[model samples]
Target chain A: MRRGFPVWAVYALGFVPAVVAFGGGLAGTTGPDPIRALEQTLGLWALRFLLAALCVTPLRRFFGVNLLRYRRALGLLCFYYASLHLLAFIGLDHSFDWAEITREILKRPYAFIGMACLLLLIPLAATSSNAMIKRLGAKNWTRLHRLVYPAALLAAAHFIFAVKSWPLEPLLYAGAAVALLAARLAPKRRPSLEQPHEA
Target chain B: MLIRVGTDLPIASSEITPRSLWLRRRDFLGAGAALGLGLTGVARAASPYSTDEKPNSRADITGYNNFYEFGTDKSDPAAKAGRLKTKPWTLRIDGLVDKPADYALEDFLKPFSTEERIYRMRCVEGWSMVIPWLGFPLAEAIKRAQPQASARYVAFETLVRPEEMPGQRSFPRIIPWPYREGLRLDEAMHPLTILATGLYGEPLPNQNGAPLRLVVPWKYGFKGIKSIVRMTLVAEQPKTSWNMIAPDEYGFFANVNPEVDHPRWSQATERRIGEGGLFAKRRPTLMFNGYESVASLYSGMDLRANF
Candidate 1:
């Protein structure tokens, strides 16, 4: 029931997983392969945040819940996690062997899909600032942000492919992503009497 | 608990390995009570090659497994392999051998004495674990058969009971059922190759191959076929399950060589399970999983080509 959810709160919550992963790593509690576990955790959070960012529009349209202020924070957090996921693969797994990393990106479908999703997110992250948003004009900025939909789908694909077998957790994330995207396609209904009309 | 050792005490090199120390901590504590009596040294000196790396925790080892018969998910084997009937198992040794026979699991193991071997298990997926296995050398079993001179390869096969193995019953089976693996005759006869029947000083868990399994220390884990039902000495290189399914990805000689990368990923480094944190750096993979003794087996052959 809290209105105007603070953007700083979203950011603080966003970093909780990172802190837990770091603490667990230091304590040697992450289990036999901490690097792989950390990589998976980061990638999963990236997908969750991306899906959460996509949920904002549908939530406002259908449920009359306004979380527009925190949408940028969620999107940025998604990008942050995505970056860490890639870093874990390249730095920890590959040991900065650029040749091997490039080979993996080209040869592995999951890696290619993940890299593509991150690449698409880079422009969105760059244009997130108010100054760039104003410079690009409202219509172009809105159009550019639409890329989030495809990026989310790519991320879901990456998650599915990354696992040796298709597990339920990744499938559930993919299903949620599809449902959110489908909700955007639904026809907008007339404003309810209880809801305030946007000027 | 801490034990002060005198300078004159002759400690086995294996006792110093991180994995041996960590895994034998309980035993070590008990032995610490009688440290000056040299009882602990006698017990520790028995192992042939115990690496310095610590074996993964029992929880990690038992909880995470890759027995595809139960299912493909790492946890699935632990959850479902309990259904397997390991007691009434029989192993068949035949083909190009002086004696072709089927022996009950217990009867087959009666002739040989089991020894504890701590080895590094490197999965083709680029994850690795140090395990202490209880079994006798594969050479002993092969010697019993008296393989013919013409025999050039050894083929291994796992049980294919879809009724018990849910993964085999899965529609659109992932890998071919009745999983198969093979090794060159020389590789099979090597002292490092073992037919493990127990692990961690206990009867092997159902998920960890139950009654019997192969433990080829220097090869990728898949080469160490589990839940084995048949082993045949053949005149030609036998077709292996992984090699048949994805010939390009998995080759006949699936040695743990960092130089040859899997089609999907690099094998230069591997995540050592139960060690570093989630964000911890991966350890660089060692050739033949650090078993330099087996290097002579592949002399003059291109590992990358074989891979």
Candidate 2:
């Protein structure tokens, strides 16, 4: 077996819990509080999958593990989970009441932030394909992908604000993300072989 | 022996006619439904929990809840409440009461026959539920306590141990310990309101305030404190849990009036729990939860401020 797992395998594994969670929610099989269980599961998976996608770059740089092949797969999984999260909210809570939904979007600050995050992810997901990346050019694609950083922050904020009274869990995730980004920015010693080749 | 033929309590007369009993049953069911027992299984005329009864249909069980003891989620109480320590519970009735006493759970509950009353429970968050509650009037319980003339208001306190309830650890310290609720003497003695010990028949589920809880059918659910540990009859209005947190948002008289909307959201409409899909239509909320007969009591007072 290879030291590294395949990207497709990782993606398949990620979807398993999410699909089961959604199915359980739809089937009303969640033990007692089915609605709450479904909501928490969808939201947790979306954030967890998004964090996994964020880790790909740092993992590659820090450990010299060139798992670039898995980045696209992880990114796709993030989109899938986020979409499922949105659908769960729409299907279970709103019950398709457009008027009520519009009211909630306007009234509740968390709903607006969540929708904003979802909107930002749509473009990123659409352009995740190799063909789209080739069309956009590598430099332009990198700049566009940077949007994920803010999207993650916004998603975390949505959770924090929605649960106005409790913020510990969400705060922990936000703090860790900030630390990860800080690690990315910290100056790194250049490799002797790369410096000689450049000179 | 005091004989209750149908609904009439004949203290001295023992010779009861079948026609009198039938008439009394008719008066009891018809008047009781109107007076708001909202009883179940009986016909619309003979029973209170009828399909077409607007007031009975509107009592919301979903929104009006303080599940903070179980977890932060709105639905947490229904699930996590099953684990609560409900047995061997006692309610200490003291302070300005002529008969300052502690009643055991069974003895406290034994005197009255539990009746199911459906009421709309509106939450500050903007949702509502129609719950079928099993209990007698709050007035009956308080009368048994025999409050002194000094008792102008009744204060209720919930259990506060962090070990028993996990949510206590999560709440902001600013929120007062042992969630409390209060009611004016008249409101406390309102015939429509109930001191609920059981719900949906049998004993109350823990999350639904097992053992004992108040059911103020007219007011919001938070006014109905669950897992009550103490009942103190006081002269002043007690500081309620939500009101102390945010005064403007939650008020003392948390009546279910759709007209006086919450600052964060509208109270004009509510989603009937377990009724619609994600796209289910929201039904229009009623004034005073359709308790027009009782609406006049608050006519002169500022409902928005009191809310």
Candidate 3:
């Protein structure tokens, strides 16, 4: 039990806020205007946490920080919160109006951005399983997961435009995503393995 | 007595109060208060403006707000405002005024008679709401303040603190703190403009600018700053939040004229809150939010540039 402290604690800590949000949502505590602001906040946080998770892999591989097992859990958590955010829109915000939903997806620019992000995640989540990864092969799986880069960008746009004013927060997230992507694309000098006999 | 279409008011200038005319038309229904009110309603039902009401575009006056001083979330004011100690509140009046005086919230509030006026509140975001605000004309308050001639503009300030407001805890400033707003002397004295202390017949929720907040009927909602901590009669233009952040997008006027669109989106249409029907219908947004009664005050100025 004591040995499980760190892992369980991380999971527990993350669950606290999500559980509070869920309870608050269920209790109808947010007065009349809850769904739009709540969904945007949760989606933004999920995207932020996902970016943090994505950074873990790069940090471990490039900077040699092997203590990165938490990334997988955090990534799954982001997907969990993001799924809730999508559910809130369809269930609460739109009340599952099929015709209205269709029109919104067609007419609203931000709606398309949100839809694209959620759609991209479905495949990513399906491929998250170790069994599905083995079936796809490691090389193919990595390429598929690269969709997260665009997904994050789309999610940020979904939030920025969702607001009537103050795009600073969304702009900051966009900047961070661009910087991370740039770092990943930066050319690295691979050390030649076969070296002549050194003195 | 011309009741012309596209005019600020439907009735002639002789009949200033539509409510009074409406009451007379309802006399046939009999004189009891409830029945009289219902009769007035029947008259409203028969009016051409009934269809133009664009009822669906109304916001839940309770929710359509962003008073960040109390908290960051839009709903925070409504939720966390119960904690605000409004009773025994005192307002200190000073600076460029003939009389520098301090008054308690209740004593100062008692003399002003309240009227319920439904005004369209347009957020810079494109969505809008029609709120039934219980307020008195701001001109009444300014008249009492009796500012000196040097006082050319009215400036308002919101209480500030990083600890109480989570938005302030962040590194990058998302919005200007002590959220300031201003109005030119003539604009501040517009007949339709109000100084609101309550809504839905109750003291305003702290998020909605409890104690006192200005409601410029013709301007975008943010111009109605909340949690007002101070009011000063100043000589120059005050630094407003949106203007300081992006001057190109937010002008000093920030009027609700559909003609002057925000750079990012069209203001020609709006979604009225609380009126359900997802993607209900689009109605032509009124210039100056149907407050042309006050628009002439800005006749010589360029609205496009001032917007």
Best DockQ goes to which candidate? 1
Q: Write the per-residue lDDT of candidate 1 for residues B69-170, one digit (tens) a residue.
A: 887777889899988987678899999999989987767877887777888999998888888787888999999999999999999999999888998887
lDDT of 3 by residue, B1-307 (tens): 3312112334433255453453344355455445545555543333221122322221356654577654556665566556666555666656678876777666566667766556677777656676656678777777788899999888877766566556565545667686889888898887777888766445566667776878887899889977666777889888898798789879988998888877655677665555433323445578887777776888898899899
Model 1 residue B267 CA deviation in Å = 1.4
Pairs that clash in candidate 3: A164-B125, B57-B272, B57-B273, B58-B272, B58-B273, B59-B129, B59-B273
Superposed by TM-score, candidate 2 places the C-alpha of residue B139 at a distance from the truth, in angstroms, of 1.7
For residues B1-307, could you state the per-residue lDDT of candidate 2 as single tens digits? Answer: 2322112233312134343353245466666678787653453332253123332221124332456776766566765666677667778998878887787766676688666576666655545665666678878878988989989999998887677777776644424678888988888887777877654434566777767788786776678898888889999888888888778778898888888877655677775555432334557777777766677678799887777
lDDT of each: 0.83, 0.70, 0.68
If the candidates were sorted by their lDDT against the true structure, best first, what order would they fall in? 1, 2, 3
Compare candidates 2 and 3 on TM-score and give the better one: 2
Write out fnat for all predictions, comma-separated: 0.50, 0.07, 0.11
Candidate 2 per-residue lDDT, tens place, A1-199, comes to: 4566877798789889877875775674543334545667777777777777788777766665556777788777878877877776776665666787787677867788888888899899999998999999999999999888888888888777665344367777777667666767867657863354334
Candidate 1 predicts chain B with a TM-score of 0.88
Query: Which ranges of candidate 1 are over 4 A from the true structure?
Result: A1-19, A52-74, A90-113, A129-132, A165-199, B1-54, B148-150, B162-166, B169-172
Q: Model 2: runs farther than 4 Å from truth?
A: A1-4, A31-40, A62-67, A88-92, A188-199, B1-66, B73-84, B125-128, B146-151, B169-176, B257-268, B276-281
